[model samples]
Target: MEIIILIAVGMLASLCGAIAGLGGGFIMVPILALMYVIPVSDISGTSMAVLFVSAISSTIAYAGQKRIDYRSGLTFAVAMIPGSILGAWTTGVIENRVFFVSLGIFLVLMAISINFKPKKSRDGFLKPNVSRSLLDASGQRHEYSFNMTFAAVVAFFVGFLSSLFGIGGGSVMVPTMILFLAFPPHIATATSMFSILLSAFVGTVSHAVLGHVMWDKFIWLAIGALAGGQIGARVASKIPAIAVVRVLSVCLLIAAVRLMFKG
Candidate 1:
């Protein structure tokens, strides 16, 4: 029964993940923490294990829709590796109580970021200079600009956060692409999931090496995520872009408060 319940939760979490490019960790970690089903120190690792599987599942689904920006996503994903390894090392040394509170604070900040009105970004070392255009399977044309110079730097931190909090960094990646990279919301989410696949893979391996993953529970979560990933891709196509971001913002706030009161 516990396994069954966890699978259900995993499905719901992955649904939110695929739609918002969250990698399901943002939803899985807090709920597991709140439920006290596992040790706090192990939660992030377990979440990463789940995220790794879900990222693969969602990326495949997104590919079918042709929503992914593979060239850019691959570059950013490669940039994430060093930071991911470093963050996994750091997680092994942090206090569990401090970890939960920190995760809560991070979630609150993500809520603010997604809900905040987007402003035009100024030119800097990170300035986007390269233009890109793509036509999706649905006949929509997307035009955007982003530079690898800034994207690589951001991807490094994104990888660090994915390992540190087990939220898979989608909360940050999606917004960064949409606001700074000028990517359309649908494309941003799709591409973010692609980058998350690589980051989660690195983070999960690092955590597993440190014995942070709980394979017994993580197995069921992965199964549910596999199914949810397929459904979420289809659902995302029908929803308005604004609705997806709004929903993510609200969910992040709720989860943030829940985690804040924990530990």
Candidate 2:
């Protein structure tokens, strides 16, 4: 029954991740603590493992649909490396109460960021220094520009938070890309998942070396997450941009409230 519950939770997390590029760690970490009574170290490790599996599954679908921005995603991934290492190192020293409270507040901020709708680029709301245009599977054109420097700074922080908490940084990346960098919602979600693959891999390895991961539980959860990720990618492809943001914001807000009380 416990295994069954993990699988169900993994699927739900993956689905949420695929839609919003959150990697579902935000959902799984809290659930593992509240329901399964897993230790913080093990929970973070397990969540990272599941996130890697889900990222692969979702990235494949997004890639096929041509939704991923390889250049920008690669840049973000490169910038995140140092922070990922630092975060992994710091994770062991952090107290659970502190971690929970910080994560809760961060999630609330992310929820607000996602819900914020900016004006047109010409209105000077967005930095127009860098220009990019992507054609999705449906041949629809999405265009935007962003400040690379701002993105690098944001990516570094995202990497640190993701490694420390095992939340896969998708929650941070998607909103930052859209709100801060002026990326299209769908492109931001896809690119966020694409970039997270590397961070998740590094974080997973770091946790494994510390003996924080449960290999037995990881296998079943991974299997469920892969399937869910594929389904979510498909659903996201069909949804409106505003609908996706709504889903992202609502989920983050609920998760934030729950984590705040848990702390």
Candidate 3:
């Protein structure tokens, strides 16, 4: 019964994640913490494991539709791996409550940014010839010239944050790609998922080594998420952009509040 409940929750969370292009860790962590009595300290690691499964499933599904941008994905992924490892190491030192609080604040800010009314144009479309270069939240440059050096720096930081917070780093990566690098939202999402796949896999391994993973629980969750993601993706394509954005804003706001109060 417990396992069944978890799988159900995972499916729901993954559905939302696929639609929104989030990694689903935010939803999974809180749900597990509250319902299963999972330790907050282990939430990041466990969430990474779930994310790994969801990323692989979503990537495969999207690939079949030819939606993935391989060049962008590979370039960004190459930079993110090392950063994830560093983040995994850092997790050992930080307090879980502090991390959760910070994550809450980040989510709230992200929601506001996403929901902010655009002053420039009502044109919902992004321009072509937009550069693929990115400037992360830290103000570091991640150029599109396949600059491995710059990518490495940015990927490392992003990876660290992903591991530490259990997010797919899309929350950070998408905005960075769109606002700084000028990539369209859909393209950024595709690229971000590709990058997240690598980081989440690496983070999961680190968590397993640290004995923070709950395999029995994770496997069931993955199964449900895989199925749910496909459904979410289909729905996402049919929904209006304004409606999607509104839904995302509400979800983020709720998640932020929950995380903030959880501590």
Question: Which number leads on lDDT?
Answer: 2
The TM-score values for the models, in the order shown, are 0.89, 0.94, 0.81
- Looking at model 1, how many pairs of residues clash? 0
Q: Looking at candidate 3, what is the lDDT of residue 168? A: 63
Q: What's the lDDT for candidate 2? A: 0.83
Give a tens-digit lDDT track for model 1, residues 127-199: 5677778899989987767777888889999899888778778877776776566777788889999999988
lDDT of 2 by residue, 1-263 (tens): 98898889899999988988788887888887787666677887888888989999999999999999999999898888777777777775777677777778987887886676664641112455667878888989988877887898889999888888787798778877877788888888999998898778887888888887889989988988999899999999999988888888877876677667767
Task: Please state every model's RMSD to the true fold in angstroms.
Answer: 2.5, 1.8, 6.5
Q: What TM-score would candidate 2 get against the native?
A: 0.94
TM-score of 3: 0.81
Q: Which ten contiguous residues of candidate 1 have the minimum total lDDT?
A: 117-126
- Steric collisions counted per model: 0, 0, 1
Look at candidate 3 and tell me the lDDT of residue 128: 34
* TM-score leader: 2
